[model samples]
Structure formats: structure tokens, C-alpha cells
Target: MPNPLAAVAAVMIAVSVAARALIAHRGYLAYDDFPILSMADRNDPTPDYLFRLFNNHFMPGGHLLSWLALRFGGFGYGPFLALLVAGQAAVSVAFYRLLRLMLPATWTLLVPLTVFLFTPLTLEAGTWWAVGVNVLPMQLAMVLAVGAQVKYVRTRRPLHLVTLGLSILLGLLFFEKAILAVALVFLVTACLYGDGLWSTIRRWWPSWLVLTGVSLAFLGLYSALATSSVRRPSSVAEVLTFIGQAISHTLLPGLIGGPWAWFPAGDGAPIASPPPAARWTAIVITAAFVAYTIWRRRTTASRAWLLLVFYLALVLGLLGATRMGSVYSAVAGSVPRYIADVAVVAALAIGVALCGIQEREEKAAKIRMSPILLTGLAALLLSSAFTGIRYGDEWAKKAGRDYLANARADLATLPAGTVFMDQPVPEGVVGPLSAPYNRQSEFFAPLPEGPVFVTQGRDIRVFDQAGHVVKGWIDGPANRPGPRQGCGYRITGGPVRIPLTASTAEYWHVIRIAYLSDRDASATVRLGDGEPRGFDVHRGLNAMFVVVYGGGAEVVLESGDPAAGICTDEVAVGDLVPAPAN
Candidate 1:
């Protein structure tokens, strides 16, 4: 009754476009997207400059698309991610169009496009286009490649086979997850479509060999090389729940109650464990599908079951590998979302269940059922699109305009490799400041590269690679010594915990100086209060520290150190700690 395939594609793209435009209208929806704008504003904006994503840390292809979108979208994270989501809709269209025979038109169309509308997963994928946001592209590539393979098997056409190989190869360019795109395709072919492989290969030898080779190449490159710190699940239950959460989170839209992404149940949430509910669902689903397949013999349901197993297997393997999976779970650069790629394939594998047994009576029934299904699917997709845009689910990029004007002006003043002891992720500033600063001052600390900033005053200090401080404040900024002795405050070997407090209405400063040793640590320092101190602390084992705590204290850790002025990287002014007693 309904052309489900066309309807799904139309709805997916239309919604994605609408979302993109909405975000574009709103400006950079979130501040994190500012980094790309920062880079694009730089004079040397190249792959090298933007290597923070690929080389330094693995973010998504959102950065690539965002920079490119500058020509169209112009200065917004929302629009950039929106275009990516929209682009995937193209792949969604191609997905059902390519699956002409693997399923009835209704089943083929509904299974693939439903994922796009599955609000939770889509919303998770929608955030932060610059880093780990290309889940959509990776899925599209993986799915499109698989679809090409399906077309090859169904139609024995050389073009289909060639296209399949090319698609898989190209998909690799979009994501590291895409490296497995070829392996997944062949794995599916080998396990579920075992009978068809040989015949299909014989018919399309050249294309098959090329794609197969490409798949192998992808596997070789996709190996997890980075050192992983993610520990494996202590119990199988946690694993199941984790996997189940991904599945349930994606499929059962009603189960997810709100706009929030993850639910925190336990304090500190410590369980050297997996998500039991998720894993159990995955295992049970796989076992049931496999058992049903064995009982019924090779129908599409069995195939779907097998595919579900493969998806779970891949997810488990990554977690078992416990290296990449851990990084994926923690950093979320794009791997966990790959689980949905399997969901799509599994839906295809169980193409029969979706159609309710192709019978003469069912054919009449399908006609009636198809309309209701189509209407519901349309309603869901349209709603999802509306929610995505109107409710601000995801964003896209603006036409690449220069966002570097402020960064350039700011960076030029500071010395290269100068570590700014700012707070919060160095994405952007937030909130209002009421002058003289304290521990509450907010600034950007962790940057992509250059000089790393390690602050102990506010936030965690993971930026410090070494264990505990061997010498407490000595390793602070190199120039922080003059003002401490000038003020006559110091740290001795004994437990000297001086509760230094300061509060003022105007902006001032606080400097703590720790030298390696007080030996030869001579300081001829004139305090802003016109007090001067000349002294020499020891050299090797000894250390020295100077702290300027007041309202609007703007003296350098070292005078004439060129890198110390206009320290606007963070404005630490608040109700200040009053000037020290006379």
C-alpha cells in the first residue's frame, strides 16, 4: 500500500536538512565547535593544523565537514553535524534501494531507516561535530558497502560488484570504523550468505577479489595501536547490560524517558563490570535467533539472527580486546555507535519476521498492514526530524567564515608554548565574573597540543603525567619566585599548611613560587607594596615559593619574562582574599 523505501529516505533527509538549517540560524549552537573555527581562522589552516583530530586525538570527521561547510553553513557546530546527519540520509535511501530482494519492499525499507529515527542513538551521535561525531558517516559507509554487496549477490551484475568494492574502499576514508566495513560485509557473506558467495564470486570475480583485498587492507590498518587503559568487565552481566543499553537505547524509543543520554545510578558508578541487562538481552536475542534459525532452517530470520550474532560478536570482541572498546566507551570517538550498524544488518537478516511469513493470505494481510506500518514509520521519522531541529538535538556548520579574529589577537600576545592555568576544558569561557578571582575562576586548560597546562587550584590534574608532586609547588610556572620572599611567606620541610585566604572587590593576583631549592635562589624583589627582599635559597634539594594573593595583583612570576603579561587566558578575579596583615 505504501512505498516504504522512498518515504523513509525522504523523511530522513528532509528532517536532517531542517535540523541543519535551524542550527545554522542559531549560530554555533555549542562552544566546543569554536576550536575548528579557531583553526580555520589561522593563517595556516591545513590538515597539519587540524591534525588534532586524526594525529593528536581521534575526533570525528565533523571537523573536516565543518571546515568545508564554511562555504555553505557558516560558523555553527549545529549545522555541520546536521549536514552529516542529512548526508547519511542519502545512504539510508541507498540502503533500501540497494536491498531490493533481500527483503520485501516494506521490510527492506523500514528496517534500515528506523535507526535514523531512533531518537536516543541519533541524539548521542548528534553532539560535538568536531570530535567523535561521524558515527553517521561511518554507519552510512558500512551500510552502503554492505548494500552494494547484497546487490551483487542478488543481481550477478559486474557493476554491482565493482560498486561494492569501491564503496567499501571509499568508506575507509570516512572513519577508522570504516576499516571493518569490508570485513563485516564478507563476514556476513561467509556466515549467512554462505551458499551464494561462491556463485556470486564466480560471476563477479574481478570485483569480488578487489573488494575482498580492500577489506583485508582495511583490517590491517584498523588494528588498535594506542595503549588502552580501559579495564574489562568484572562480570558478564555488566557486559550484557552495556550492550543491551545500546540496543534498547536505539530500538525501544519509549523506554528512554527524556532528553538526557546516560543515567547515573550508583555513586561514582564503580563496578569493574559490564552492563548486565544489555549483555543479557544481546545474548538471549542471539541465542533465540540462532535456535530459531536452526529449527526453521535457512530463512531470512536465521540470517538476521546470524547477523545479530556477528554484531554482538564484534562489539564483544572490541570490549574483549578491551583496548579499543574501552577507549570507545570512555572517549566515544565513534565505536559504540557501530553497534547500530549491526542492528541494521540484523534487521535485514530477520527479513521474514518483519514480513510475517510470505503467504497468499499474508499478501492480502501485508497490503492492510503495510499502510499502518508506513503511516507510523512516517509519523515517527517526521516527529524525530522535528524534535531534532526544533528541540535542538543536533547542529551543523556555517559557511566557513573567519572565527580566528579573537584567537589570533589573543594568541599573538602570549608566548608560544605558554601554559595557561585556566579551568574547564579549554573550549570556551562561561558565566559572569565579579572581579577579584579565586578557585572559582573559569578558564580553558587542556588544549590540543603546544604547551600543556597543569593546574592544582581547580579541577583534576590528569594533565600531570607524573605521579604525585615530588616537590609540591616548585614545579609550578618557572618564573613564580620573586613575589613570595618579597612577601615573607615560605614552605618548610615540616607540615606547614598555611591557610592563605584573600578577598577583594577589584581584580588582583595570587602567585606561589617553589624553586628546586632555596640555595642560590637569590631574589631582589620589590613588592608592589614597595617592600623589597634580597635572599638566596639552596640549589639542588632545596626549593622556593612565592605567592601573590590580593585584589588585582598583576605581577609576573618573573619580571621581563615576555610571556607573563595580560594573562587573560583566565580571569581569576572574584571576591578576593584581602591584602596580608601588616
Candidate 2:
């Protein structure tokens, strides 16, 4: 029969996948997801193109995985999610194998493995394709590298050493932060089977040297070619602050709780720091935990210490590389995706700690203790899993809604050959045009063929080939009324007709204009070829409305009295919508 542990591992993987199923049908978020989708839809993703793409960034392995998924899966959310779930499953299996190598064959190991598999911290990484593409592969590589180190220690096989080196290299390519894999292996070896610090270094120097060389080469390539726009830390104070926040975030949630509020589903606001009281409490608890571990250093096995050290190293390594910039807030470093690896490390540490204590107790006397601690841990794990699933569902709903709204807006407003520019919208609003790194050619790459050019920066403005402002266009005004108080242009000539494009015709079936007249007058408004509709214009701000269908229209604002024609301020349009009240 197959190993019983395999069955447990399968269950954990299934549960993890099931928790994130809410996002299976969701569309891409307004980020690198669209660019990856664009590249994947290419008819010829040639080696040259792929090389250029990877060389432009630090994550070649991650981009390679995304390319394969998009090329084969055809940009469907389900297929991309399946790839991510598969990566998560692979990581789970690797962790199980690594645990089996360290811990005795007992059901107790399941506790830590379950926690590792089900933590809420995994939701963003598992559900978001852009994040998962980097995180999942790096995690799998890290775990496999650690397992290879364990095997090499036992069998002293050259193949295992080669496997370890290759795994580390692969992990580094996937994410620059994967350099922690070597550090983790060294810590585990020292904790579990070190004779002396010098002796350990002497024995492992060859493997260390190989991995170090690989890491240095990878760093050099990344530094030379990296096009990251993120700002790096300028001072030692910023570095310490970033690292401290990362460590506190990693520990507090798994041990004491409260980071759940940081999830996107909760409050929809980013948290800068934990409460002062909670921070103090965490500091005290951490100090006490460290003191206890030191007091029992000789009696306790190094497995627990290994787990603790690895946990710290993982947090510091990942966060230090990514969150070193002063632009990053404390809460930014605490995001669930960034801390998932830390959560897994914490869970393993807890398991190893329990195992160490139990072993020491059994050596003194044979006794069975109450399962209260185990029961509490189980409860925490279940609660966290449920919370994670709920949060995933909420986040998926928001992302899907926002994406659909943005696509609809794009389709309605942007005409073929239109050069689109983005202006920042308020948070929570639909804004695909305002997404980061949006290129002029890839605006609608995932959709049907279109002549749309989208560029980043500034608001929409129309200009002719001669660089002169194109007049009478809704977005580009030819003339400005001098000394006006309100918004929009003040009409001085005969009846001014503002032309609308095809996109505007489709987007807005109704047009509403806010205006003001110096004298009592009636202004006529015509949409498309429809008959003119007249509205009484008051001296103060007034409103005029019209409805249109199919092709573009012209808004004719002709004043009954030409002495004070019209001073129009704001013109808004929407599809068959009621006009806003003055």
C-alpha cells in the first residue's frame, strides 16, 4: 500500500485548492496579468522574444512558467488557476517529504503540515496569477532544495549535491529572494547535526561555495538588467524599520493573531502598524520564547531551533529584497502574499517545538498528556482557513466586478486608432486605462484586433499632426472663454455644436449639460440627427439634457437671446441614465 502520509498530504492540497476556487472564473486584475496575457496570446512567442522578455526583468523562471500556461491554456482564468494550484500541491508534497525526513513517523506531524497548507496568507499568492507565478515556483524550488540537502547529508551522494545546486539556481531564477534556500539548508544542518560551527562550515564549504557563486551571478545579471521602478532604502534606519515590521508581521499572526484585518476583504484599508499594545505584547512573548529556547538548548533537539531560524531567515530574506524601499509602508510588507512563506515556516517551527518537548518528557517518564494544546491549534487552523476562504470570495467578487466594469468602459469609450492616456481614478473605481506599465500597443491585446494605442501618464488631449490643438472636440477644446468662474467652456459664438466620437455615442445614450445664462433664455439642444429640444436657461447654473442612439451626435446649445448666448459649465454623459440634479 502507498504511504499513509501521502493520503494526508493529498487531502491538505485539495483543501488549499478548494479554498481559492472562488477566483476560478475571475478575470485578470489591472496589473502585469494583462501584459502576461498579451504575451501569451502572441502567434509567435519565439526564443528571441522570450529571452528579451526575461532579460528585461529579474524573474525569468516565473515569466517562463506564465508563458507556458498562457500559451497552452489560452488566457482562461481557470487554466491559469489550475497551474497555480498544481504548484501549491507540489510545494505541499515537498514539505511533507522534508518533514518526514526530520520528524518521526507519527500523526502529530500533520498539525504543522495542515497549518502550512491552509493559512490565509496563501490566498493572494494562490489566487492572483501574477503573484502565484513567482511565489509558487519559488516555494516549490526552496522546499525541494531543502529536501535535497537532507538527502545529501544522509546518503552523501553526488547526484543529491548536484540536485541541490540546480534547485537553488532554479529558485533564484524564479525569485531573487530564493537565495534564502541555501541559508535555510545551512541552518537546518547546523541545528540537526553540527559538531562545531567551524567543523560544519568546513564540511559544507564546497556546496556553499557552489551555491554562493550561483547566487552572485544571478544577482549581477538581475542588477544589470532589472527595470524595477521601486525605490530602494537610502539609509540604515529605513532598512531596520522594514526588517522589524516584516518579522513582527510574520510572528504575530501565527502565534497571537490579528493580521486578518490586513486582508483585502477586511475594511479595504491598508494597515500601517499593529496596535502599540499588541506590538509590546508580541515583543514580550517573543523575548520569553527565545529565553526558554535558550535555557533548554542542550536538552532540546536542534529541529525546533532550525525551524525558528529558517522562519526568521525566510521572512527577512523575502521582505528585505522586496520591501527595502522607503516607498513601501509597514502594512505593505505585511500583505498576505509576501508573508505566506513565513507562515509555513512558523507552522513547521511549532510542530518541531512540540516534538522536541514531547521527546524530552518521554525520556523522563512515560505519560500521556491532555490533547488541549493540539485541540486549540486545530481550532486556530480551521478558523484561519474559513476566514481565508471568505476573504478570497470577497476579493474575487470585487476584482471581477471591477475588471468587467473597466472592460465595458474601455469598449464603450475608446475608438479604433485612439491614443489613450490615463488619469488616476479614486480607489475602488474601475480603471483599466490607469493600470501600471500599460503600453501603447498592448491595450486590447487579449481582445479582438483593434487599432487602440494606450500610453501611461496624463489626461486625454487631442492634437493634430502639426502639434496644434484640435478644436471643438469633447476632450480637446480649441478656445477658452476668458474670465469664467465655473467649469467647461463658455459659448460666445452662434450655436456651438460639440462633436462626439463613435465610442462616446455608444457610451452615452443621454447627455446632460450644466450651464448658466446671464439673462432669461431658452437653449436648444440636439443629439445626433434628432429634433432640437429646448430647455429654460436660468441666470444661475442650469441643466440641459438630451438622448441619443447609434452613431455620434452634436450638442447644439443655441441661446434664444444672443446678447448672453450661454456660459456652459460641465457636460456629463451616460447610457440612458437620469440626469444629475442641480
Candidate 3:
């Protein structure tokens, strides 16, 4: 006969998957998602591209996954969302298996399993495709490795040991931080199974030696390949603050179905900002539970809690030391992905505290659920589900989704070969820091068809922040007036130098030329001492814009062939803006 608790657990996992799928389906690609997709679209399946580090993360597996999704899935969110849900489901199932190995099969088992499945704490990692791709694999690997460790401890099986190694390796494939999984496995084995630290070491020395060597080798490879430098906190107070906020403001409240409040984070998913009342309530509830468990289980509970504390310290310490220097460090802990991996570990610790470690041939205790336990479980589930759903709704409605949709629809209607000048995407799409990916051409590359883009063009169009195409023209305060009206600086021979009223700014500036050419020819424009930019001149009268770096008080223009001359009537240096519709 099937165990009723097992059936309940399966149903809960199913519900969790369903909820995740619904939320992820509603969410569109945002923030870092674009960079991954853009990179995948631009690069071929070469070793250099595949093994490239992203923001210091050596995630070849993640890169490969992104590439596959872009190739097979096109621009739709379905493939990525499907993968996201599937990975989350795998994590839930794997965690259940791990829980069974660590704790007795009873009503008590349902508590931790439900908490792990329903916690709003992991909503960010679950719904954000960019974060999910890396986080879920690491989470899955942690649970599998821990389960294998438990099995190895009980049976001393070579197969389990092998699985343990492979699981850790699998995590390292996706996230460099998975190296922490080794320490997690060691902590579980030593604290839960061994009588003393030395005894555990003696018994598991061989396993420890092999795993340590593997970790060290990977660390060396990661260090060599990753380009980002390690960041350190400026002061001791910064480190202390990170720890306090992470525990007090984020994790503690999160464990108890908080923070209940949500706020938009620009184009990214919503961030947590529970009210003070909610925070205090979460703290009190969590503290009460901790005190009760310690009083009831004495040393057994204390050891389990100690394991949790040590693991959190290691993970948080790593983040505080390395990430505090980041611009977003003040609110880093408030965002969930950095610590999302802790959900499963928390469940494991809770299970051990409630049910004790599983013994060989031990049968699950038949414990009845009390009224208070039932009430608490129901409240946590409802509150967490509500908060997670609210967050998902915000993610679904982010402005980036509308921007991309509008841009794609408008792009599809444009004439083929319509030339557009390249520019940085609006801050709503991606920040300037994203660089190559933040450029309009790169951001739009995932679309099947779009207008051609160039550095400079005649009659060029540009997409406004709303994704509408508009005529572009250059404007500036400084202009090198032509010698006479209706006739700009005429470039007939060698180099025609037109002196400006004042020197231009020292940064990049766009130069616009309204000129008449007797015949088609090549021309070059130089600003100050900067290198000359080459452009094509067409017959008849027209205007063109070209980008040049640096600035000078004089403008220089020259025709490639003296016989094929071009006459410029107007020359102005400045930024490109949408021309007013007449």
C-alpha cells in the first residue's frame, strides 16, 4: 500500500510545479535575460564562446543552454519558461528524496517538505529565466549530492559515492558557487552521523580527500578563466550590515511567509519590502519555533540548528566579502537569488530537528498532527503562495515586455534593408553598462527580421524608447558655416577646412552634412586631429550623418577623387535626435 504521506507530498510537489509554470508563463525576459539571448544569437557554437565567462561566472553549461534555446526556440518565451518549470520541478522531487533519507516518514515530514515547496522566498529564482537557469541546476545538484552522501553513510556503497561526486560536478558546471556544496555535504555527514569530528574525519578521510582535490582543481580552473575581480568590503561595518540585513530583513522574514510587501524594481522583477509589522511577526514566530525545538530535542536539535547556522555563515560570508563592493550591494540580500539555495538546506535542518536522523531499518514514527501545527502550516502556505503570486504578477507586467513586443511588431512592418543608425537601447530595455548587448542592433538580433543598422547613414531612422521609427537628424550649438548661403563647405580638391565658431566637446559627436554632389564619390570627414571617418557620397542633394570621436574648432572634408567633388551646404556637430514631423 502506498503511504498517504508520500501521496500528499507528491500532490504538494505537483501544486508547486503548477504554480511555478503559471508564474513563469506570465513573465517575459528582462534585465540579464537579454544579454544571454543576445550573446547566444551573436556567437556560434565555438569553444571560446561556449566556455566564456559571464560576469565572472564560468558557466559553460548555462551558455550552451541559452544557445540551444535561442536556436530552437526563436524569440518566444515558451522554451525558456518550460525549462524553468522543469528544473524547479526536478528540484522539488530531488529534495523530497533527500528528505526521506534524512528523516523519518511521518506526518512531521510533511511540514518541511511543504515549507520547501511553498516558500515565497524562492519566487525570484523560480520565475526569472536568467537566474533560474543557473540557480536551479545548483539547487538540484545540492539535494542529489546530499542524498547520495546520506546513502553512502548508511551503506558505504561505491555507487552512492560516485553519484555524490558527479552531483557536485554537475553543480560546478552551472554555478561557481556550487563549490560550497562540498562543505555542505561534509557538514551534514559530520554533524548528523559521526560521534565526534575526529571519528567522522577518520571514517570519511578518503571521500574527503577525493572531493577536496576535485574542488581545488575546479577552483583553479575557474580562477584562471574568470575575468571579474574579487570584491572586498570597505569596512568591517559593511560586512556586519550585510549579515544583519540578510538574516534580519530577508531570510528570517522569508522563512515565515514574508516579506508580504512587494515593490517594482524598474525593468526587473519586483523586490521584497515587507512592512515593519510583518518583519516583527516573522521574527517572533521564527524565534518561538527555534526555542521550542531546542527545548524539546536538547542536543539533537542544537546540533541540527548549528549545522544550519554554519552553512548560512559560509554562504553569506562569501557574498558579503565578494559582492559588497557592487553598486547593488546594499540591497543584494533583499533580493532572493543570492540565497535561494538555502530553501532545501533549511528544509533538511527542520526535518532533522523534528524527526531525528534516520537509522538503519528504523520505521517511521506514527505521530498525529496537533491543531496548532495544522493551523501554522495552512497559514504559511497561504501567505507564501499569495506573496509569490503577487510577485509573479508584477514580473508579468514589467515594462520591458511591452517594449519588446511593440518593437518586434513594428520591426516586422518595416521595409527590408531600411538603414538605421546604431545607438544604446533605452534604460528601460537594458542599462548602458550592458555594453554591446545594450546596443539597439544587438538587442533586436533575436528577432527573425529587422532593418539593417550602420554607424552612419543618409536618410536614417532610429527607434524611440516607445519602439516607433522616426527620422533622425543631428543638432548642436557649434556649427562651421559655409562660405556663402545655400552653399556649404565645398570639398572639390585636397582637403576643405571650415573653421567652427567654437571648439566642440572633447567626447564623441555626430556630424551632419547637407550637401550637393556633382557625381557619386567617396569622402572623409575629420574632427580636430581625430582619425577621418569615411562615408559614401551620392549624386544630387541630400543630407548624411556620421559619428566621430573627439572634437575640433575646425571641420575638414575631402573627396576621395578630386574630379568627383561634393559640396556641403551645412555642417553641424552634435547628438542624433528624432526630426520633428512636419
Pick the lDDT winner: 3
Q: Which of the two candidates, 2 or 3, achieves a greater TM-score against the reference?
A: 3
lDDT of 3 by residue, 1-582 (tens): 998888989999999989988887787888788988889998997889977887778788888889998898887888888888889889999998888877777788888888888887788777888888888999998999888888888788788888888999999988888898999999988888878999989997766876888898998888789766669777787777778777767787788787777878887877678888887888899889878777766666778888888899888988886788878777776877788888767878887877777672144333346788889899988898888878877888766677777777777787777788788778877887788788888888888786688778888887777777878877675555677656666688888887777788778888888889889988999888888999999999888888888776977888997898577767878778778779
In order, what is each prediction's RMSD in angstroms?
A: 12.0, 11.1, 2.2
TM-scores, one per candidate:
0.55, 0.67, 0.95
The lDDT per prediction is: 0.42, 0.57, 0.81
Model 3, runs deviating above 4 Å: 360-367, 478-480, 561-566
* 444-553 per-residue lDDT for model 2 (tens digits): 45555333333211123322222122211133111223245653556655777665433244332445566766777766665545556666676766654444333344
Error of 2 at 287 (Å): 7.6
**Could you arrange the candidates by lDDT from highest to lowest?**
3, 2, 1
Report the CA-based lDDT of candidate 2 relative to the real structure. Answer: 0.57
Q: Put the candidates in TM-score order, highest first.
A: 3, 2, 1
